[model samples]
Target: MSTPAALRALLDGRWSDLRERTRRQLGVVELPPHGLDRERHREHVLRQLRVLASAGHPSTGFPVRFGGGGDLGGSVVSFEMLGFGDLSLMVKSGVQWGLFGGAVQALGTERHHERYLREIIELDLLGCFAMTESGHGSDVQHLRTTATYDAAAGEFVVHTPEPSARKDYIGNAARDGQVAVVFAQLVTDGGEHGVHALVVPIREPDGSPCAGVSIEDCGEKAGLNGVDNGRLSFDNVRVPREALLDRYGHVAEDGTYSSPVDGANKRFFTMLGTLVRGRISVAGGALSAAKKALTIAVRHGETRRQFTRPGGGEEVPILDYLVHQRRLLPALATTYALHFAQEELVSTLHEVLGGESDVDDRRQRELESRAAGLKAVATWHTTRTIQECREACGGAGYLAENQLPQLKADTDVFTTFEGDNTVLLQLVAKGLLTGYRDHVGDLDALGMARFVATQFVGVVIERTAARPLIERLVGAVSGDDLHDRGWQLKLFEDREEHVLDGLVRRLRAAGDGDAFEVFNDAQDHVLRAARVHVERIVLEAFVAAIDRCPDTEAAELLERVCDLHVLSAIEADAAWFLGHGRLTPARAKSVTGAVNRLCKLLRPHAATLVEAFAVPTEWITAPIAQR
Candidate 1:
């Protein structure tokens, strides 16, 4: 099960040169020993962050002038690689470099950048992103914290208007942070401007809270104790007007609020959109965690002897069992798929945030929708994959040294943070629906008539022509290759299109009723459409990456991995395919059989696949996995 040197080289080249070097450097760091003492763990992570910062790792995504390489993709790749080690360190680093520092870089004006970017990048000034309030986690618009413009003093008075307005679950707020990028409602004599971000001093350089700012440690959690999560309340905490991170919107010295974007809602959304890189980073980190969990489980399965042969010979490896392959192989395939999807996400993020592309509003919305959907999928997958890996390892996984327990505990919150998975899916669906409406709305009178006619024709063609077309195409290919890339892509695309088309029809049928009620009724259907769309995108990325492989043997092996991923997805939702007539009952049954066969085919490569992750032995300190 040893990976070929050629394949190892190819896998190593998957990330950029900067990321490869960062990964190698991270491997050499001496991590603190694992324990349950939260305070001690927090200190450990803080020390680790300092180490990473000293290594020039945290500055990858910032501007080159600010001691950063200005390499967004490389930064995310490094973050993902770091996840193979201590997740607490990974998260703490993300809070410092990704969320807090990224907020400053992405949202701040040039003056703010010149003043703070270098110091933040160098870890000279620690900060937190103070956005999620006690009453508002996902819903940022309604945050009860207010930043009132004081015209006479030329200051913005930041205050938590109510207890619910307190910034909760804020990383670095408890101990390390000296400043915070606070999101609050902006009020001036002109009007109540929507949510805006301001740089507010949370603590002085002496590690004490600044005047009018009260901080409370959010003691103990399900996991990630190393990250110092805390709550902060502002009691008329006034900051200079220049503290506003006014890339999108700003207030004048005379208390006049203005923005490049006309509407308050648009301005608010534009501001929030700047931080989408955080979502991408989270997804990549979650994928990395899933890979580590699978590596541990698969490696354990490869070596752990479970049952005797029929003739009472030596015990066989657990991986030799069909059930064990079924449990772990598909997950491994999914890890690969997620890896490819995350790469694409990182690239897109770099394009938008690296200032290399002129991304329009439409493109930005599309990016946000995709990031939201993929983050939801990837994090949920991590949670599921880790749980399965834990169970697959049996009792040994429960042991702390095996790392699965800690992996499971730490990744559980990933599903809710960044954005709640459920809410994010809804955002995807909303984006889809809005885009669809806009597309139709853009048509002229004659074009509208033609569009309706075309839609009618499309429906007729779908009902009458699509099935026979697919069947004929399937007939041309060997039944064994039904799980081939072309067919799998078509299957996923068709399923997503079908779900979206149906959702649109259902919404149209609702017809001028209470919009909220209509949306509520279709929420489940909308979520399904979003999930299907994201699955298709992930599958496409996986197939494309496999196609790019130059080594024949490597390509063939990756194709099999892709087969496992696609078939497993098909098998999981077999009932849906069958009910929709997309798959005959016979084909549906074959999907299950195909998945099992692929699992068996891939079992021997399990250890090799995980080894290609190149996790340092120091990072994956799981004893059972080591054996």
Candidate 2:
């Protein structure tokens, strides 16, 4: 009987005040309706980005000394909230602020910050995070674009030498971006350094491409037309040597390159690691999109009646039928679980980054691995969940006005961007096999395979949250009582361990063969290990959140939700459990039964579960949901 508002407060977590304030602000900021022409939508979104800046949406995460709110947690929460409205607006904001502004803050030195952060924050300056290239979306280490130093001229010549090296699908680049944080191979003193970011102007004050910069509109696509995605290429674009965002790697006036870290491999990762916030932000945003989608579907399911009962009573509400409930409720439960997991991720991102103290490399790598895994899992979940939500609401969900079609269209790209989900999960598996001990930046498959063959000692399961509580719960479990929290935690933990151990053995068996080929063949197992590890982390985070809830009423409700989430996860992978002999056939069948029972029990409360998402009412304008 917990009220929606009460559940919302529990779900709001650390930045509750900021979230509420953002919700109100977003309500007042009217969004452009669906079906605007491509240019008009892009123009409206651009205007809206300015409105967000004037309202202080972009300043929360920056340091207060530079005229920002300095609320790291609040900054990310506000970004996440954007998913409640037009996703184009969210991507635009992320481009202007999260990626463009974030790169300036994280990768650039103080001079670059002092010159750029205020303008970037105030919307006077718009920029693109030009990292993804046509050929190198996932692989950042070998970009073909070059920033070679010219010592005599006291400048760096930035050029995109090949078609594949052109910056593609860059937000802000097509229309509004004045500058770009261009990542390119840096060469100085006749020696090539690794990939580095440079602050290069792509457009002039008059809104024309700079003299040496070429821009092309990516054109309207399947979705997100409101964002003016474009491609950028430079032909010997010369800028002052100071253009380099040299916080991690520096080029002196004498054309000497120096870095605090040794080796190009470590230096490349260390530099990329500083910009981890972008990936984490994408995860948060994707989670919110999933929440919005589920809310609509669940609310529609509550009222949209389907076939009548067998005995000829009133038409049954779709949500009450077991088939319908089976479709939506388990997803609803897992969304709740991911909410807690994402909150935990944001908190970790806040503490490890932007601190006055030096960042611990081990901590940073662990954070990166977790962020990668979560981004992979969370966004992929959003893609699947949103699609499922669309289907669950039937024809009504198909209409553009009801919003599921738009949601599905816009979010389809989430799984690939912010690092491809498949590649990211491999990053997680590499960390697991390497035990995250030595230099933490190398995630190349060949490197990982070789490392596993040489250095991987064993599979170790490290607890992520509420260590003592999780340990006690896990240790006390005896039988496969699915409802017992300990047993649930154990299943997740054991699965990850088994997957990791098996993966290590498979890679090591390759001996002196081609490491890359061996790793490539076992890519599915690698992704599975990463996914299994993420699910365990997510479950532990859910358990920890429930323990922290003060209200017995709320905690009890969440307990059932968590149970549904865990059981559904097991049911989805029951084949693996039975094949591993970890779950007897009868026990596996019981999990599906338990999931159905929980869905039935929770059917009456489905509205409350999704409403806890607290998406702004103005945004959830679907008529089916409203009624």
Candidate 3:
């Protein structure tokens, strides 16, 4: 709810207004034209592409030199706001800006950037990120598409080569796209260079399929039907060898290939690391959608009368009921934490791109790890919150007119898209292992010796010891009457380390070629550890916000919100804490008690927090507006 002044200022600039006008234009000229029927929704998605092109969402992200506004931050901000009108429209806009234009800006060289970036940015050429294939949804390296170098003609021949190689579930593919940033294994006379992106023009200027490119529309989906998702297959599609976006690697004349990064595996991951940007944006997008649902649910609950109050003369607003408030308010607190985290993420992105700090190999991995962790946690949370928001609305929630079902359907794909949440969380766990490994080396002999002695001996020697002085410090500040933030944080940290150490030991024990097998087998436990780590991060963020609040009332409200977040997160993982001795029976009970108390305390601010998002009045006007 508390936005930095600079962020607020950016939100008020010309770009923001241009974005808002784009939304209004979309709402007026786009949605109505698309219609609601399944086929119509797909048509509408395709039609809205042209509409957005006219309104300039696609061109907003590119540099002015490339016929764009050249403001990435402003563009994403505007893209997020488009969700206020319609998510389908927002997604179509993303397929244009984030995928099509972004591919050129991030992966392509200056020549490629100049050649195609302008048309793509201008929406004169709609494009798709043709990366996900039928057989290799998450494992991009295993994708079957191939780009074989042809020395005679000096062009690379692209081919699906098989059914599994067909790029599946691509947006803007069925009806609108002329180009796609196709991900395929680039093979030359030298060797197979993992996956590389090639700009393939899949449609001609006359809106007809280009030579050797075939598309099949994926039929109606549960959500986002407004966006056409199609399967694409290419057969001996040829493009100049120069089409290879050679930022990381390149092919020389006479069929030679070279790269700055030596290791094949490292180069592969480095290329995919570009996708971390999308994952971070997805996390922010999830928060924006969750906040929207919470806004509607809270406002409706505040005004809609339910069972009788103590007086018994008339029914009460649903929000006054303890059950209703408890169900929705904690979700509101999470939305706040996610919002703050998103700001941090955007700042990191700008820092890396602006060269404020070196985004070297290690830093890139760290950024990817954090982005994945946040995306997994936030998307999973958003889906759950959407369900809770719908249930809180009771019958009206299911109605098509209210937009809850539509919102839920559209957002459902977020957990799996960008990257599968489970897969991503494991990446976070691997990052934690890497961090621990770094510490073990950094600590040297004496430090390592002390760590080993304390971990092993302290447990035995201090078995009967009472709570430490810090426990009292935690309880004093937390006021929860049982456990405290200090204990919860400590326990999460300890448990995370133990889990990672155990997994690593198992992995090492598995030995040779089965390393992947060992890693896959330990994935469940690793992901659980990652979840715990993310929860701790969110709790710390919540508490930090509360600690820094300058206003008395705001501070008190923030403290309650922090309590709500921590208690709810603990209750969600009660089994883990109980088994690991992090929480006693009484402390576990207090988690629920704290949840109830904080939920009640936060009920009044629920609507306020959502409104602070500043979504346009048209999308959500008041507590009672039906549309």
For candidate 1, write residues 281-389 as lDDT tens digits: 8898898899889989988897899779989989999999999899888988898888777777777777766685555676677778889999999999999999999
TM-score pick, better of 1 and 2: 2
Report the number of clashing residue pairs per model. 0, 0, 0
lDDT of 2 by residue, 323-430 (tens): 988888888888899889989988988898867678888888888999999998899889889889989988888999999899888988888888988999988987
Error of 3 at 422 (Å): 1.1
Alpha-carbon TM-score of each model against the true structure:
0.93, 0.97, 0.86
TM-score of 1: 0.93
Q: Please identify model 2 stretches exceeding 4 Å from their true place.
A: 1-3, 441-455
Flag the better candidate by TM-score, 2 or 3.
2
Q: Report the number of the highest-lDDT candidate.
A: 2
lDDT of 2: 0.88
What is the lDDT, from 0 to 100, of the residue 11 in candidate 2?
89
Top of the candidates by TM-score: 2
Candidate 1 deviant stretches above 4 angstroms: 1-14, 356-358, 436-481
